[model samples]
Target: MLAVIRERYRAHGFDEIETPVMEEYSRLHAGIGGDNEKLAYNVLKRGLDADAIRGAAGDPAALTDLGLRYDLTVPLARFYATNRGQLPSVFRSIQIAPVWRAERPQKGRYRQFVQCDIDIIGDASARAEAELAVATLDTLDALGLEGGSIRINDRRVLDWMLDSFGFTSDERPGVLITIDKLDKLGPDGIVAELRERGATAGAVDAFAAFLRRPTTLEYNPYGERQIRKALPDGAPDDIVAHLVGIGAAVAASRGSATELEGDIPLVFDPFLVRGMGYYTGTIFELAHPSVDYSLGGGGRYDGMIGRFLGQDVPAVGFSIGFERIVDLVSERTDAAAPAVVLVHDRDVPEGELLALKAALVREGSRVRLEQRTKNLKALLERAASDGYTAFATVAQGTTPASLEVKPLA
Candidate 1:
């Protein structure tokens, strides 16, 4: 599955890159990862005595200088800053690696897992967002999955909506966090929670009224009309236009056609607030009808690189939840080499058996040597379960041409 994703990414002109799993403690805590920061695993500083550890005023920096990365984007930002001179002006990179989070494990969630990410840096246009959306959809198709769609919303629009509702900048973050729980909390619960959070009463009332307003959220292909319908009158014109441009581009570039409006999977989600704080513009999540959660997601973080270089560089990335999608894949598109087992007798010389195996390998076969056992049926069943397609008996001086291979039942 990882190979499939890697090949798909490379086919899209993204160059593979690697970064260290560990990063400086400061960079990881740079206030961008949202709740993931709280979940980060901080390493204790080495050579600290029990008293020294207790004496550090409970500051994490006092205890640790480095920690494992919680996501790939932060490391990528640092990588671009450090290697900007050598990379292309418009760089496309592939990062397939494991990231660690110190959160409690849950079903379909792990403390350490692999993420398959493709990022485009140095392109600020809607084309950057479009390319990311199209490429991710293509990769999902390559994995033999179906009914994948991208739900997109811009940070600008969210901020605009909040401000229009009279939310102060200070209240915006907390409001967005509660808004993110709309699916679980519902409208009334959101208003109640906001009031409990001591949000300005008028702002809460305004927000509640907007939520209660009549809006048709029916199945419509995400376009200008659906986008307008989802938001109040007088939403930012530039953000709306930018989203429309991305939809049109994705529709044109997509590999498959559908009956959905515009025949594109792009949909405008007015309430889709991705938790990553660094996302400065166009945020998106990949959804498949098969499951309730997103298979992958990403967005533009045009300001992140600037933090390291003292100048902003536009960047957007999409990461497939590799662990979530692997089990959901029912079929594989890439064919594996034929696997063959050498069921050999004890009397056979180890060197001769190895020679036979090597000969088969040179001919493009995956060969495994197994000693002949009395329970031949059980051995063959185990081999079949392990994905060996065929087996052959080997004896003294048996050559590749002389061995007759039989297919496993």
Candidate 2:
């Protein structure tokens, strides 16, 4: 599974890099507030008892602790800082590894799940943002997602709307958080939550209306195809406009068919609050009807690296939820791991077995050889019953020079 995802990123010109799973507490906190920050699993060294560490701080507020990385992006930024000289001017990297979060496990969400992240750093161009979206789309496309669309929004656009409404700093956070729940709770639910949270009725109504309407292509060709046949062509373009515009910019820059004009669908959505403070520019989420969970999502954070580097460096990325993708792909396709059959013939001496195994391995084949008292015919039958793709004989007519290989199917 890791290899499949790694190949996808590598084909897109992303360098595969390894970063430590354990990170400093400060580096791990990317200001993605609310339950996100609390979800990180903190680490304490062995021999340092939890009670002692808690007591060492004296005051509850001043403990500098370490934590297992909550996500790959934060540690990737740290990696860039540490290896500034060795890395390329424009760093495009991919990491596939386990990330720990303390969130409640439910449905497809887990405390220990693999997050496949692809990021581009040091370039603030809209091209970076578009490329990130395209890469994410391509990854899903490879996984056989035929009916989903990539919904995108810009944090700048969201902030613009909030500031335009004259929301107070204290009020904006709650409002944005509630507005983020537009999908689950619906417009009416958001209005109620906002009203309870002290937002003016007018503000809540306007916010709900804004979310319901989004920008898009001039003709409702795609919208009609998606929502219904009776919807008007001039339906609000709020979300569609933003996504199509970014996608256009990306297409104009890269000249790739996967851009705005490409067949890969792009949907605009104002209510896509990605639940991260680090996102500064374009944001996106991938959704498909086959699965309820997001395949994975990410966006551009222009000055995110500057928060650590002192000088601003633009960055954009998207993470592919390996488990979600695997789940979706499994449902739609018959792709499964290849099986290897162990071929052991008692006629072959044990001394020459190692050479035969090595030769098969050198040919890029998966081989399994274990001692078995059963005859070759029974072994082959068992291999077939077990769904092995190919079978190999340990010894061929008492000559140990080569393996007897044949396709099981």
Candidate 3:
């Protein structure tokens, strides 16, 4: 799964970069939330001596000084920090690697999984965000995933709504965390949950009502409230009209008759509430009608690299959950068993065997020659039992120079 995705991104002009699995504990804590940091697996150092190793076995937590990578994006930022001068102005990369998270293993979630990520750095425009959507659509199309919609929203818009209701930055994460559940728990359920969490009734009700309202906001280069202020009373009809116009523009530009809108559905779902703190402008999720959880998601993070470089380098990207994609592909397509052919040519000249193998390969047959030499009848029987379509005999061709090809059936 990771290899396929990595190749696809690489073909699309992305350079493959690798980051250290073992990171300094302080470096790993940069910008990540408390819960995410807690999920990291600390790389504990064991003492060299046998006695020390045995003594430290009972209290191994004290010996750890580093942590495994929680996600690839942060480490990429760190890499950019050290090697920024050596990199190009507009950077594109794909990282397909394992990340560890100490979470209770459940459906679609795991302790260790591979994240297939593609990111473009050093740009700050709505078109960059739109390209994230386009790349995501392209990737899913390549994978043959069906009935998935890319839901999009801006974190700035969410921030505006939160601040408009008098919520501070400190309160914003918690509020966004709950509002993240507006879909799972309906308005009433969310209101109840907020109240249970000790939010005032007015704040909860106002927040709930605001969230339940039309999610489409005018993509204001300035801000959402300013866009509303330009309009009379910030009517939902006007906001929706702006959204429809922008969404249409997005569709017309990215979606031709082929890449999207037929098997893979792309819709403007403004209600998508991606809870990552790093996302700045546009955030999105890919949801399937058959699967309850999102297949994967990503968004724009303009400030992420800024924190590391001391200068803002806008970027947008997404990670595909490779395991989920494999499962989906397995369920969606009828899989065929591969044919295996065992070869008994260990003592035979290598060049002759390779030539025989190449001849069969050129005929468009899925032929694999096993190198182990065994009794000819046993090899033939095993090849038949292993579901081979055909078998070939490669030898010195003494007396007769012609080749013998036998159907396994």
lDDT of 1 by residue, 1-409 (tens): 7887888888888999999999999999999989898889988889999899889957989999999999999999999999999999999999999999986889788999999999999998888888888788888988888679999999999999999999999989999999999989999999999999999999999999999998665766778888888898899899999998888778767643422435788778889999987999999999999999989899999999999999999999999999899889874321357789999999998789888999989988888999999999999999888878899998887888899998887
The deviation in Å at residue 350 for candidate 2 is 2.6
- For every model shown, what is its TM-score relative to the native structure? 0.95, 0.80, 0.75
Q: At residue 82, what lDDT does model 1 achieve? A: 99
Candidate 3 residue-wise lDDT, 253-357, digit = tens: 655432233222444444466755677776778777778888888877888887878888888888888778777764222124334363645677767766766
Instruction: Write down the lDDT of every candidate, Cα atoms only.
Output: 0.89, 0.69, 0.67
* Regions of candidate 2 where Cα sits further than 4 Å from its true position: 30-34, 45-64, 146-148, 208-245, 249-264, 331-340, 345-348, 373-387, 392-397, 400-409
Per-candidate clashes, comma-separated: 0, 14, 0
Worst lDDT 10-window in candidate 2: 221-230
Q: Candidates ranked by TM-score, best first?
A: 1, 2, 3
10 residues in a row with least lDDT, candidate 3: 331-340
The parts of candidate 3 lying over 4 Å away from their true place are 1-4, 45-63, 210-249, 255-271, 331-340, 345-355, 358-367, 371-390, 393-409
> Candidates 1 and 2: which is better by TM-score?
1
Model 2, 313-408: lDDT tens digits are 888889888878776664322224334564666676665676666665676655577666557677767766755667665553434354455677
